[model samples]
Target: MARPTLLFCGLLSFLLSCGERKHIAIWEYPEISPSPEVQDYFGTTVIDSYHNLTDLEDSLVQNWFKTQDSLAETYFLNNDLTTQFKNRFHELEGRTSGEVRMIRTDEKGNYYYLRYDEDKDTDVLFYREKGGNLETELFDPSSYTNEKQNISYLEPSYDGTKIAIGFDPQEEFTSTIAIYDVINKKFLKDKITHINPDFGEIEWLPDNSGVIYLYFPFVEKSDPKYKKHSFSVVYYLGDNPEKRTPIFGWDKTLEIASDYYPKVKIGSSLDSYIVGYAAKSGIFYDSFIAKITDVKLGKPNWKPFFKASDKIYYNQGEIREQYFIYRRATPNGNELCQVEIGNPNFNNPLILATGSRENPITQFEVTKDHIYFVREKFGVEISIFKIDNQVNITQLSPPFVPGYASFFGESVAHNNIGIGMDGWTSNYIRYCINDEGDFTNESILDSPQFQEFKDLVSKQIMIYSHDGVAVPLSLVYKKDMKLESNNEVFIYVYGAYGESMSPFFSPTYLDWVKQGGILAFPHVRGGGEKGEEWHTQGMKELKYNSWKDLIACTEALIYKGYTRKGLISLYTNSAGGITAGMAVNERPELYTSFIAEVPRMHPFGLESATTASSTSYIEYGTIKDSLECLGLIQMDPYINLKQNKYYPATLLMPSNSDDRIPLWDSGKYIAKLQKYNLAETPIIMDIDYKSGHENSSNYDAAMDVNARIFSFAKSNMRY
Candidate 1:
């Protein structure tokens, strides 16, 4: 652990009690505060170390983590099925497989693709045949390891004969793609080495002209000073390297010119399929499809489609010749549409189905008659809507009752396409769609990890908010676990950028909840709860609404006799970190403590800060835009610290390799508060070295965090 240094001296702000609704014994807070000073960090001239500490803290934290990261790395790298977490969550024990993500297919009758291990360096990929013939293989990524050994992404070609493989040794080295001969067991010499590899898409052109080549233009910062900027070409390689071309064309009015959520847009005609790109305009990345109407390879020439944070999933199987059903976004901007094909000349895209305005329209598979897409709601509800002239809709899941994370099924693919539905409380029954469009074999994909959790005698509950708003929260304390009003509690909230915190079972969390701790959540604004408006409402000027709603929920927790002050904690990262931090500062009375994990908040007084593309620009008006928004005035955690006298003991953390908020935001606040804090509060600066934004992925790092959090709160928030 690193030590804290004092820079200034001032009186401590008077300590106050927990929120008015709850009570707890109190301790003294330091009355001293720091004076401002200018310093240079990472070559950037930060105006004042007191307010701008991103650079300084980043450097120090990075160094600290580098020295101590090995142990944490090994702890999490241990992929033991019986791997134990400190706070065992009883509800999650049998319910989750600990398999982070997986995918499935209909060709093999009932097959699925799953990640073999949690360790990236030694991970495996398993292909379980529909009838239960599981084949396992080591998928090494294609880095510069002297051999073609890597699996950055896996996209089985449309014909299933070739798999497009994308892998990179490191970011400094551009990712490349290769053709893995599925049937012949050979690597193709005509490998398409692109700037970045994609696992979601592949082209099976009519003539086997090889996969379409795609590329993009990228920019890299010279130093942290923000003084010099340079650009680089992210090249793409296809069939004939000699004939291959790099994509470079981009229009500012039409393109976002960013790599945040970059994807190659491909348009298929009767003859071939080519590539295109999208740029970020905040959360929305506008899409452009490749117009191979001409021979030259580059960005699409046709007008762009709407924007999306993720790819609109389409079926890998073809729809006759020269065309296939593609997932299209709602032109009216409400729900996503299952169009036949955007290209008007080929086949007119019929509105086959539409998802709720809240969740983007997902593309699963296209049959002669019905189209399958999950109708999303408080919980995921699978609904098979008809295509073309049929125009019929059917619901798949039972009506949601509350206290359930989501009714969404295990997304074997990005769109959760062609998979059976589950309400989180039950085992998943994975069925297949036969050639005649008949469904059969409702086999259970729920592993032992999931079955273990179902033994508990608890059911899901839907808790309504003050406005008759049904906030879906998953709750499972021990059956013997006391529902005592004063028990310890923690809730995680991250509601922005179309991000949905899935209700999958986590062992460590279950252990904690089972041990008499109440683990809960609030499906609040600034997320995909209701729709785009829900997220927009909690972002920017209205951003404070998220924090306020969280605070309201916390109050409701105690009022409903769920938990008491000095016994409850809040967890959030990225954008939710801002919400958690602000709530802690504004209403210190409600929280026992809070964790600001890689907080994505404006460093307030910090200088030269970069933010996430989605909510950051909206919440914190950028210097480039120059247009002032009310959001910039509010939602500043560092700025509001001076007025926060009754603040909770905080855990400030950031990853040095984190590309988003960096490390200074947490540092600046701590450096300034050390002087003025009157409480016996310790500013635990949790740092990770080699880790990127995935601060919690490492088991040891997560354990260290849990230990630190336990110690911090046990010592300071004790009643």
Candidate 2:
């Protein structure tokens, strides 16, 4: 008898391959694989590692890249590997996921939220109706968990009179929040659309009739094309329907800030005022205190809360169009000050922080009694700083997890306070100081998914950077899990621009930890946690301060017996991709593998955003300044792929239609590595088709990718 042939052998085998599957995406991308034309555009030469005298020689990049196929085919094939790895890792990671929706208070003042149950394939809204008596109802039902369209974005208002519901129906798109009046049990005819951009937070103004706060983006009246402009307008509830005021709008003349926008953080105690940041371009994001005294919008009661200017050009010759040369760029960044919001501009705005390495202060907020903001430390966690009569920096946890904490994307309200601690071999708890200034409560609200693994320890140590700076290191290792003094480790770092990571709690315990994994974090001089003083250590092409810091952490992890060099792995996302790719190029011995997921690796992709893209200026420095060219050269990850060494086996994960980072990053980096790298490492790629900027898909799809990541780790670390 002839051997039974496998059904659809080639096609089925490809589908069943570790990376061939798809999953439920949180931020679903319409395009996972790019067109051949797009791939052709992402051709590359090489991104510098250390910039040696003969770095340009063909021999330098020979083995480092795997350029056997056309740029498109190489990325397509490699992404296949990445997907298989992620899919498997997803399944192995088990049940924990980040899918929280509405967070509200119960009758007894306890917290409640909406959660999506993947197993049940339904959206459930739970409310703390009574003491310990949580009431839950099925909100939405689907065959599988949704990727981007989540129920959490829809929130119910106080007294249950109304609910603000978000609706993003189409793929690679977003929808508006429709008010569902519970009392009337009907959908309110008057809807607020095109107010705040999707991902913008929604706060109910005092009056139940309508919203107190409105987000009016900058409108280019002259250009009827509705050009994507910068600026924001705050709307009040009592406006004469047709004449709502634009709380914070701007004219194009302001070179620093072309349009209008709102602040990153917002807080409100009454229907009276909402304090936030307005879009006034340039380096400065001055605070604005908008007091809604009346609903009749009157030129938005014009006020200026904060403002600052930066050097027209960075050190790399006016910062514009300058090819990035590591370790060189403008020394000038931003100087932030507190602005009194009541006039055309903030009066007596006190300077809070200055940008030496990159942008000055990123996030700031006024809680019940304190003004809290994060200062970008040079390539580390943002030092939690409080400003009142004097600036007080609080260490919430050991410097480890990236500082900018968000329990959920888009929504900013989260309880990210408290501290977590663990011993080298045991005991982990989240600790925090109460208002009275003492470690009052334990931060462990939820138990670890796998405490049996021993509480992962996160501690700080000093690491040596290339420039000899004593970098602060963050480490998390399983407690008493039979780990060798120098166990195989996975060092994760993101040292680009001035963004500092923060430490918070989560159950992101996944497949790697299941098999005895250790994580390492480092804060180098390229971030802003130390204030303008520290941030200055990295910026422009001199931005190497961050790269140096990342490498230092890897070397430190190995030297301190936290890990073994040849068995270690490096994992990073976005800007962190720069860290992983560059460090592997510079110090191959420190790492054995890497994961560069949806990184902004393509330098040329930093081309200016069209008139309609809202986030055009956030990642790539604002293009108006001629000097940002130098900064891009330095900060863009794709521009700095290193060559000339035995690179770690790297897995590149890029969303096919990534809007934020753009797919060019993955395409160009992969192309360059293929054509360049001196080491012939297996540069596997996981190009998530049907997903874009976000690696979210339906439920089954997500778990599959997670499963793959775990399996990949196991397969690669036997050495």
- Which candidate gets the maximum TM-score versus the true structure? 1
Q: How accurate locally, in lDDT, is each candidate?
A: 0.47, 0.46
TM-score of 2: 0.67
Q: Cα RMSDs of all predictions?
A: 8.1, 10.9
TM-score of each: 0.71, 0.67
C-alpha root-mean-square deviation, candidate 1: 8.1
lDDT of 1 by residue, 1-719 (tens): 22232322222222223322222323222222344655443343433435423334455444433323332232222312113332332234324433424453432233324342434433344444445645645244423366634355565543345556655323222356676666665566755543433212444342334544334233132233221111112223243544444332333444444433334433222334333344332444444444454423344354554335433322222332334445543422233343333553222344545556544443344443455544445433334433433556553433232222221221212222244444434444444543233445344344444443453433334455445545555455655655567677777777666454445444555544544567676667676555555566676666776777777778777777777887877778776876777777688778766676677655344323443223245344543432223354356666555543656666666665454555566655655554445555444445654444534243343554554444334334445
Cα lDDT for residue 190, candidate 1: 58
Q: lDDT for model 1, on a 0 to 1 scale?
A: 0.47
